[model samples]
Target: MEKQFVLMDVDRNVYEVDRVLNAQTTNIRSFGSEWSIRLQRLHGGLSDGVDVVWVDNGCTRLAILPTRGMGIWKANVAGVPLEWHSPVQRPVHPTFVDQSRRGGIGWLDGFNELICRCGLGWHGAPGTDVTRDADGNVVSEQFLPLHGRIANLPAHSVTVEISDDGAISIVGVVDEAGMFGGHLRLTAQLTTYVGSNTFEIRDTVQNLSAGSAEAEMLYHCNIGRPFVGEGAKLHIAAAEVAPRDSRAAEGISDWPTYTGPVQGYAEQVYFVRPLTADDGRALAVLAAPEGDRAVAVRFDTSTLPWFAQWKNTQAEADGYVTGLEPCSSFPNLRSFERQQNRVVQLDPMGSVTFEFAVTVVSAADDVSRLVQEVADLQQAERMTVHDQPNPEWSP
Candidate 1:
């Protein structure tokens, strides 16, 4: 088989990997395998900066990049913001859904159960919804109401490639029966603008059969290290947070009120706004402890409108972090909703395309200038207030 991605060696660790077209061998004995170090460089070629790198035993994703849920490890983006942790590793051999366990830190506990046993990573949604026993005592806990994940579907793995222009692109595909089946692709291109780093990703669904199929897609990211921490705080441009369980009578209607300086959220996910104030852009911001750098995740509300905010409430034993995810659908919850026509409809032969852009910036990056532009969008004179569609439910 042709090689898909690159393998790296920091000091002296022994590992086997294939870069682009050829298989390569490298040693990293200096940094013991126990370090949990995993990093990728789209360099030693045309670019100077590394694309995405994870350190401390994959406890943290050091750089900026897109992450799909890995079975047994926590993937972090930066130091403080987003973490993707899976304690349960998918079964390696049988390749079928069966109740089993393996001898590793990451092992499959059950169907869709990927727990993070350890690290500074992002904790995922627990599989069982509301587990009630015969006696009606809830045996299991529900993490998020509509969380969804795309794993092992035929070509569902993530792909990163370099263009001849020295620009690198990363794409994640989610399709029917992937690892090969028809899939949905979300692509991102890393480029620079006026001395700053900027990237954009496009979401497209491709049907593989002559007949039609239903498709849903989302871009999941893990941000941690260097950028996230305990003192870190989140600043969002949203006007409100939608109630995930509006069906609950006592559940607050329009449940999440946008209180300025929302704080102390760990392992919490909220459906939020994609509002552009006076100007014409929507922004989500997080301020970390170091340098008080405010990492801003800004996007064009017109393309991808939904955003989600997550924090680490679980103990470190879960190996997760505080995360702010901008997704197209609530994790693992899309399929059921789409079945009820809650998210949207897709004809067998038809497809929908959207885009999301994230810019990691410091608090001094002139956010006030961009915020002014966004504020202008809020005051548009010709628009009706109630006519507004809800800010995307998934960020």
Candidate 2:
């Protein structure tokens, strides 16, 4: 008698059949009740010359794009969306653009995932500047890309490892260095376990030059509709909250609440310096007002000390997205950051590591527990700062 066996795919869809017959007709390899990672190319609508590393561990599924600097393009937990996507429709190659117009906004048009990395030189625009070329010749009117080129640069060495114990990880190294510019190297790794709803990201950025280099880094984790809509709310334990600019200050009072999309609604950015918990980690959550479903992001405050909340509630046709960002400093022009002494500097051959985890909360009891955790954190003592320093009366 032929033995009967069960098979499962990344979506958790299962099938039962005779093991011998199935093995004879298909390429089936038993992982011994373990998770699997498949490396394949995304074709047709999904492709613009990119390779995807797909992972599923029963509880969650992830699509990682190596050509896009290994950024997670999409993720889900038990069929529930865990990340926001832009209206770009398809993934585009990094070099498909004219050199004159390549920047953060250009890249943003293609894919906006749970995370988009920003900066080795700049995170925001500060206009043109004077710089020296590789030959030590002074060059003027040199403008850095909106968020640097790290995200658009493809990974050089990629490795995906899976263990017998049902553990899997993908590692990749991306270089964003130039002849006369900062030599920055990003080594990123992501790990997940079988049957776990949580995954972790560990990244190390190193300055591989002989001189100290200025750096800025931000993880643009976006949460959107269904998970971030009317009645959805954000809970964070922050010591201080400051508006990114005058535009954000207009909606300062309603920073933690969600509202329906408004016509001509501009984006608002709030800087949150969270109060670290006992383990030196800061917790933030976005939950549906009426459901047990929620998403949580936890990171070490020692490395990522600042968090930025980006609220974009424009017309539905355009996009309604919220960004939960954790970074070494605020998202500002590199020059301004240097003026404020907030720029991160790496000595020659120096490196810094950051770790963060995204977990899915699906149980009502667990959701309640997280709500309480946020409340407790809010009650903890904190240093307050003035939301606005310079206020001008506008008639």
Candidate 3:
């Protein structure tokens, strides 16, 4: 039998768990065989009123924040840290994240997370989103902020599930609703096993309104330092590779390679159409400088069909990190992505599922195998590496 704890159920007025896991512990007899789950309320600083759920499964550690869209703030696998050094050093409460600030890019203030989900309404570049009458005259226009509002919204319902077998799951539901924005609910679950080097994030975005709705999502899996410094490489099997702009064109020749932090290096992004396996699985890996260790992402392309390699190797003080993003579409503005047929449409009360797994390779042998897997997928198709930006894929 499995034990379930409700951490927050807004409709039922159940707000806190108050250290329930501390009172009830679980144990096994192999591979370190221990798991500890803790829920803590942060006080003071920018994290005021924030709730964090920590799941330490012997070999791995996860910091999941329900207050900030149920994002996994950071994680550790087999003693190796899988996180970037963002300017925001802590898990910022939604109250501190101002999406409308900075002319629109204010989302960067709370941008540091191992897996920060973007979108529920619109996850794309900031721009003017317009709607027109049947005859094409503009009816309404608004400035859509960057990456939507899911990451800055709190989950209304959260639960922790622990099976007698020692597996762990953290479930959260974040709602994006307003008089003007309609209603969309994101039911997310993060699951892992004791002493395992892998974990999975499963999300189902639902339309909770009486009418149809639009949704977008991207998993911004950011990594830095040990897994992303000099000599690092990004492995992916893509049928097409394109630079986002002229700036990214400068590095198109060495798209998969990385260098140490440079003081004035501007950010560059490459959009890829990864080739999916027969099972609809897409793989991307970021290998360490030594090539003996790495982190891999396996996603189902039936839902997330685009991949973005975000290169921001700026100085350490300025936040040096890279992102291996698996997304439903490129990070172009919502209007632009919709024109490219990238935005997803949902019927009333309909939903879509996005599933992906993150695994860390602690051994040199496993790293080689994963890299080979990417190569095998690529060889099946002729890859088109565009020297400059692909206007069709970029804004």
Top candidate, metric TM-score: 3
> Which candidate order results from sorting by TM-score in descending order?
3, 2, 1
lDDT of 2 by residue, 1-395 (tens): 11222222223453221122122242333334335566665556546567666777777889877777778887888778776656665566676633235443565545566677777566755455444467867664566556667667777666655555555677878888888876889988888877788999999989999999877888888878667888788889888887777888888778888898787999988888888888888999888767587888899988899888889888776677888888887776665565566678889999988888998877778877887898897788664644552221100
TM-score for each candidate, following the candidate numbering = 0.52, 0.84, 0.96
Backbone Cα, N, C clashes tallied per candidate: 86, 0, 0
Alpha carbon deviation, residue 206, candidate 3 (Å): 0.4
Candidate 1 residue-wise lDDT, 292-355, digit = tens: 4544566555534566654443443353444455544454343233333434334555565655
Residue 44 in model 1: shift from native, Å?
Answer: 26
Model 3 steric clash pairs: none
**What local distance difference test score does each model get?**
0.38, 0.72, 0.89
Candidate that scores best on lDDT: 3
Candidate 1 or 3, higher lDDT?
3
**lDDT minimum window of 10 residues, candidate 1:** 114-123
Candidate 2 vs. true structure, TM-score:
0.84
Model 3 agreement with the true structure over 1-395: per-residue lDDT tens digits: 77788878999998765564632343323334667778789999998888988888888999999999999999999889989888888888888888889989889888888899999888878989886677989887889999999999999999888776667889999999999779999999999987889999999999999999889999999999889889999999999999999999999999999999999999999999999988888999999999988999999998999999999999998889999999998888877787788889999999999999999987899999999999999889999999988988997
lDDT of 3: 0.89
